[model samples]
Target: MILCFALGIANMFHLHWIILFSVVCLICAFIILFIEIPLLLRVCPTSPAFDGFIRRFETNYMRAAIYFAMSAIQWISIAAKRTSLIAAAVMLLIASLFYALAGVRGQGFVGSKTLGGQGVAQMIV
Candidate 1:
């Protein structure tokens, strides 16, 4: 949302498509994340730890992608370098923060060794 808003503020007419695409992606991501609940009750939903980590990773990745894309677009469309620099900074910050956090978490959740011969992991998308 922040990324989208920032792009709009940078150049409202130029970034309208980017903003729309970002919103649509966000809505789809939310729906997929929410839909995981029912799968939890099914025979072989992913372990909570793995699922949680995946969700968080995906969410943060999405945010970072939006920031990066918007930053590039704004930098191309607008003359102001400062706005682009700020967006780039925010992108780096978010990407680093979430990935670092995910790594710390995945260590505990993903376990040291992989479990072989487990059921096939089903992905919605």
Candidate 2:
């Protein structure tokens, strides 16, 4: 998120590039939302191996939600057509705050010790 914000700030003079970047990010986010998530949900229920794969990666649904929120905010900024860089920066910062809150609430990727320990054991075996 910091990287995206920094890129937006650095390219403030090139609004076209920022807009393009935001579009690309939104595309990737949609791909994950539409394709990857459904596949994961379908496979995770009946496939123990796939469940292990997901656990091994420490996938955080909370973080994914934050990512989706950030992508939506970027599109909103583009649509508003006014100080998009500033708007993106503020929105991304708010997203980061939600990310931190997720960590505090034990919803972060690899944040919970019990889950982290289980992941380590699964990986080792």
Candidate 3:
């Protein structure tokens, strides 16, 4: 991932590279949204319930927002105005916070460890 990221960075200096990176990122983002959601639903059978719906909403929302933020990097790099840079920076930060809070660490969205412990493990099984 780091290597690909660095390569993308190196490509940013050229217009073709920028376009290629944009297309690739967009495709990957779409694939993640299309593929991961069903897998998550399968992994979590209660996904259509009220609480499950809320969890899926937060998770997918943050995931999409983070990808959107990531896709803005090229725009940020090419942006000429200070205001644009600041706006991009702010969006990136907010997206990152939500992404972190979207439960990647297996804890609940708010940071309590109630979702993935032995208790929940037994229920999931």
Candidate 4:
């Protein structure tokens, strides 16, 4: 990611890195929406009250909506051309926040105690 930013800066005269950045963001959005959602469905059971597909859809709607919005915004930025850089930056920040939230969703807060503690377990946040 730092490499992407460095190259983007180095090529600022043409603003070509905006294309690369948008493409990467689009790829990430696909993985989050298509790949991760299906994988999560396999891990988590559907609600008994609803049909399987409907339950899966209901359970995952918020995550799907967020990723879908991120993807739409990135694609729209690509089309905007003149303000693509600013758009990309905003989208990237949103993507980073959501990704980190998903990654840490079930983990205890940073610096929290570990199981079977004999001593403090180091945590890096």
C-alpha RMSD of each candidate structure in angstroms: 10.3, 10.9, 12.0, 14.5
Model 2, residue 16: distance off in Å is 3.6
Each prediction's Cα lDDT score?
A: 0.41, 0.49, 0.44, 0.44
Q: Is candidate 2 or candidate 3 better by lDDT?
A: 2
For model 1, residues 33-78, the per-residue Cα lDDT tens digits are 3332334323345677755543553343454454444444434433
Instruction: State the lDDT at 46 in candidate 3.
Output: 47
Compose the digit string of candidate 4's lDDT tens values, residues 1-125: 33324434433455455555555554454444432334333334545442343334322334445545554555555554654445445655565566557555753322213321223323311
Clashing residue pairs in all predictions, respectively, total 0, 0, 0, 0
Error of 2 at 90 (Å): 3.0
Ranking by lDDT: 2, 3, 4, 1
Q: Which portions of model 1 show Cα errors greater than 4 Å?
A: 12-80, 84-88, 107-125
All candidates: TM-score: 0.28, 0.32, 0.30, 0.26
RMSD of 4: 14.5
- The TM-score, computed over Cα atoms with residue i paired to residue i, of candidate 1 is 0.28
- Estimate the overall C-alpha local distance difference test score of candidate 4: 0.44
Worst 10 residues of 2 by lDDT: 34-43
Cα lDDT tens digits for candidate 2, 1-125: 34454545454555454566555444444433422243433433446664544444234444545555565656566554654454454555565576567667777354332333324445434
Top candidate, metric lDDT: 2
lDDT minimum window of 10 residues, candidate 4: 109-118
